[model samples]
Target: MGKLYVVGIGPGGLQHMTVRARQVIEESEVIVGYTKYIDFIAPLIENKEVFSTGMMKEEERCREALRLSKDKIVSIISTGDAGIYGMAGLVLELIENEQVEIVPGVTASSAAASILGAPIMHDSCNISLSDLMTPYELIKKRVEAAAQADFVITLYNPKSKGRPHYLKENIETIKKYRNGNTPVAVVKNALREGQEYEIFTLDSFDDSNVDMLSVVLIGNSQSFVKNGVFITPRGYKL
Candidate 1:
């Protein structure tokens, strides 16, 4: 039986991807992933067999990757850290006894945090606003808990056409625990093409600027903005 590698491409930029991730893709005989993720690594996978599927076809894609891995070295790719809201879990669940390796890469939260200065230097947690696989109530509970705990929070899949108000509602939930002046940062296409980011206060954040491609980071009570930089103090003595 051949081995399967789950690779994280890291925000769709070759520069952001790990060397191990690139090596696995280059060494694999077959590549499988979502259509957009496949396009991200198109340069490395030339002359290799690639299988791509669109959104919501994750099961089909994972199964195909497993099937091909039975006799061929297959690499399945996910955009930003395979283990974080990526294909690593699903692929692991579907495999019977296949040998698999998970290669970690920079996650969206890290990428966005870097662009927004030290907003996540203290304790932090990531929550997804997408309600497709998870119940909205559960997501809200997670958001509220994180906010109450004073953790710097990162919101993924923040807004889309169908669930436009979800992000705003969550922002209100956060406001209950955090002050209006709490620093908030929205990063779009982080570390990739057309990258853009803006810092705002919790109350002044404009949800209209966010979409599925954006990552929202909100600071804790102790966080502050100075010299155009968002920072959450890590209890340093300086």
Candidate 2:
């Protein structure tokens, strides 16, 4: 049996992908991922057999990758770190015979933090507003608890055309514990094409541009904005 490499491509860009990930993909005989994700690394996968599925077909994709791994070294690709809402976990769950390796890559949260300054310098938590796999009520509780605990909240899958109001709901819940002045930063398509970074206060945030591709970083009570940079101090004397 051949090895199965789960690789994170990091926002679908060559510059952000780790060298190990690139090497694995190049050495693999087959590559598999979501159709759009595959397109992101299309330039590097010359002459390799590729399999792609549409959105919401994660299980099928994993199964296909595993099947391919039976005969060839296969790399299952994902955008951003595969362990965080990527294909790593699913592939692990379905792996029964293949030797698996994980190639980690940059996550959007870190990429966004780099662009927006140090908003996650201290305690922080990431929450996904999408309720496809998680229940909305449970997600809401997490939002409220993260806020009450004063954790720097990084939101993934903030909004989509199918679930347009989830981001607003999370912001409103954070307001219950945090004052409207809390610092908020939104980074869209971080390190990828058409990237955007904007800072706002809790009360002044414009949800018009937020979508599934955006990562929202909302600061805790000690967070602040200075000269267009959003920062959450680590409490060390400066």
Model 2: per-residue Cα lDDT over 64-129, one tens digit each: 989888888999998999999999999989889788999999988888998898999999999999
**TM-score (C-alpha, index-matched) for candidate 2:** 0.97
TM-score, each model?
0.98, 0.97
* True-structure RMSD for candidate 2: 0.9
Which candidate should be chosen as best, given TM-score against the real structure? Answer: 1
| Candidate 1 lDDT, 61-156, residue by residue in tens | 999999999999999999999999998999988989998999999999999888888998989999999999999999999999999999999999
lDDT of the candidates, in the order given: 0.93, 0.92
Flag regions of model 2 displaced more than 4 Å. Answer: none
- The weakest ten consecutive residues by lDDT in model 2 span 8-17
TM-score of model 1 (CA atoms): 0.98
Each model's RMSD to truth, in Å? 0.7, 0.9
Q: Score residue 173 of candidate 2 by CA lDDT.
A: 90
